[model samples]
Target: MHKELRVAAYAVCVRDGQMLLARWVARDGGKRWTLPGGGMDHGEDPYDTVVREVEEETGYTVEPVALLGVDSMRRTHPRRLGAPVGFHGLRIVYEAHVTGGELRYETDGSTDMAAWHPLDEVSSLDRVGLVDVGLALWRERPGTGRVTGIPEHPADAGN
Candidate 1:
């Protein structure tokens, strides 16, 4: 078995009852809405990662206002050659505010389109569990910087 650890950052940017989201392109050719963030680069701070990722995916210059919470997830799945791989992910979530930039789609990237969606309609969209987790952290602002009760899956996110 192969073991892997990934650290990433995400942002929950909400303004006037609308949340910013990016359309993630899955390996199976499906699309799902997700937060505007991604993995950290080598030697990169998670704070910088969130700012850079949000710009890349959503075409917005954002300032992380507060450290929302962290979500840790683990899973094991078979690789292409049938070898089992154990994956652990640490996601740092932030409450971000958009400062500038225009809405645009990411070209040849993990996400396709960027848009603002009404918060009330988020639950009805085809989305990954991280979306809910980020929202939960944003809404509850848990003291431990953690959230619970959301269903997570390996395929729902990646670095």
Candidate 2:
């Protein structure tokens, strides 16, 4: 089996009872609301990654204020033309505040749109599990930089 490791950074920007989100376009052509972040480039710092990704996806310049937590996940999936691969992902979640910039949809990117949604309505939207994880970390602010009991979203299993 093949193996791959991915490290990503995400930001939770909540303000005035709303949270900022980006619309991610999946490989299957489906879309889901997600935190404003993405995978890190080789040699990139997770902190810088979060700042850059948030701006790229949401058109908002943000300053990551706190290291919320890290979430590690593993999955197995078949490659398009090869054997099954084990994918390990380490997602760094941060609490960020918008410093500047306006809300605008991304162009020619993994995410196509950006918007702010009420925190109370987040659970009812079609979203990736990371959104919940980020929010949980933001809310609980656990000393261990981790949170538990976030259920996996069935539709997000392959993400």
Candidate 3:
């Protein structure tokens, strides 16, 4: 089994009662809406990672204004034949705002589209866990930089 850890940065950008989100294109061509961000490059700071990822995925220049919180999740899934691969993701969340750039779709990238959606309608959208976690941190503003009360996954309901 292969095991790995990934560190990522994500942003919550809200303006005019809407939130900026990118549609992530999975390898199988399915899509899910998510916050505008991605993994941190080697040797790059999380702050810079969020800025670069937002521009890459959403074509919007963002300035991270505050450190929101952090989320850590782990899962084991199939990779090799009947073998399980373990993965852990440590995500750093930030509160950001658009500084410049126009809305555009990311070409040849993990995300293919970006758009703003009404905040009240987010619950009906198919989204990744990061979105909920980011919003929780933004709304609750836990000074400890850790968001609680949201379940990480369906399996976590039992924990």
Candidate 4:
């Protein structure tokens, strides 16, 4: 199987009518916005991974406040993973509250800058598709369910 099981987490932090996001160039040379979170190390807790990742990427300490939902979607695409590829990902989304630290870009992470982008402006910036899903889960805090029948690629690309 060419599929890799990837586990990741993300935080939705809203402040002053804006959402704090990590802006970086995705591997495809497309600028994308995402919550400050990433893959978890084996034996590491999802909550801990979000905290560690956010600190590393956005220089903010966050405490996960709610379990948004789990996205068990299979996504396939060319050059998806550093090269033409396919992927199956299980992503854990969470609602996090800022606890400590200042907002700044940390070079150690993939993002070039950490800042609050107004929610109204989200559409103007490039984004990973998951952001909308994350926002949905964040808004509803749906628990323990799978959003099924989702296609593995951009809807327009195929049947």
Candidate 5:
């Protein structure tokens, strides 16, 4: 039962209006709230994996600017605490524009905290549906669109 097809890269760092999140440990341990970015190191270049995962999970320094949707589905990689999933899960989602760093909180990496989450309180916290599919692909900046993944998960996003 191995049909893995993973390809990731995410970001949606708004500003003054607030958004720039990053607070990992999802997949059950709860407390999810993403945005910074991750995965994409094969031929590398999902916009350099969102500029090196937004400076390694929120040290800032973004600038992706567009391509704001592409979420593909098919589950079975949830119990991930380490890595190496097994199934289709292509996530591209971008729309950055931070320009610099300084938010801090890269506690040795895969994220811990970084602020600016006020896009109307970001669905009342407790996120994970890739934060409303990265704010609805950054407010349907959809020069394209497609979000269909739900064999079993995602439904905590409030607001």
Candidate 6:
């Protein structure tokens, strides 16, 4: 079986009883809300990756104040248009605060929209599992830094 590993960084930014989120547009045009962040570039620090990704996806400048937690998962999944492959994802979560810049939508990117949602209403939104995992890290502060039961892919809504 083929094997692949991906590492990404994401941020949780909450202000005034609301959280900032981005609308991730899948390759098939389906959309789901997720935290403001993405994959790390080669040789780049995960902290920098979170800052850069937040800006790229949400049009807001942010400063990651604390390392919230890290989540990892290994699973079997499809690769390209081929058969099953082993995929390991290492995701770093951070608690961030918006420093500057105006709220705007990202054009020509993985996410098309960015907006703040009330924290109380987050449960009703169509969102990726990562959002819940991030919130759990921020709220519960699990010692192991791993969040169990997140779906391998956000597109798998049943998970």
User: Which candidate should be chosen as best, given lDDT against the real structure?
Assistant: 1
- What are the models' TM-scores? 0.96, 0.95, 0.92, 0.81, 0.32, 0.91
> Model 1 segments beyond 4 Å from truth?
157-159
Q: Which parts of model 5 have CA positions greater than 4 angstroms off?
A: 1-21, 24-30, 36-61, 70-93, 106-127, 131-143, 150-155
Per-residue lDDT tens digits for candidate 5, residues 1-159, read 445666888888787898888887643455577777777878998998888878887777888877878776565543335454456667788887888768787776656886887799888887667777778767756565664442324532210
Residue-by-residue lDDT tens digits, candidate 4, 1-159:
365678888788887788888876554445567767888899999999989988888989999988778876665666534454456677788888889999888785567777888888876766665666666666566555444433333431111
Clashing pairs in 4: 79-83, 79-84
Candidate 6 lDDT, 1-159, residue by residue in tens: 988778999999999999999998876788989999988899999999999999998889999998889977677866678788887778899999999999989999889999999999987999988888888888887788777765655473211
Clashes of 4: 2
Candidates arranged by TM-score, highest first: 1, 2, 3, 6, 4, 5
Clashes of 3: 0
Query: What's the distance in Å from true for residue 3, model 5?
Result: 39
Write candidate 1's Cα lDDT for 81-129 as tens digits: 8898898889999999999998888999999999999999999999888
Clashing pairs in 3: none
Measured with C-alpha atoms, the lDDT of residue 110 in candidate 6 is 88
Q: Report, for every candidate in turn, its global Cα lDDT versus the true structure.
A: 0.91, 0.89, 0.85, 0.72, 0.71, 0.85
Evaluated at residue 31, the lDDT of candidate 6 is 90
Query: What's the lDDT for candidate 5?
Result: 0.71
lDDT of 2 by residue, 1-159 (tens): 898888899999999999999988887889999899989999999999999999998889999999999988888877888689898878899999999999998999989999999999999989999899999999999999988898765444333
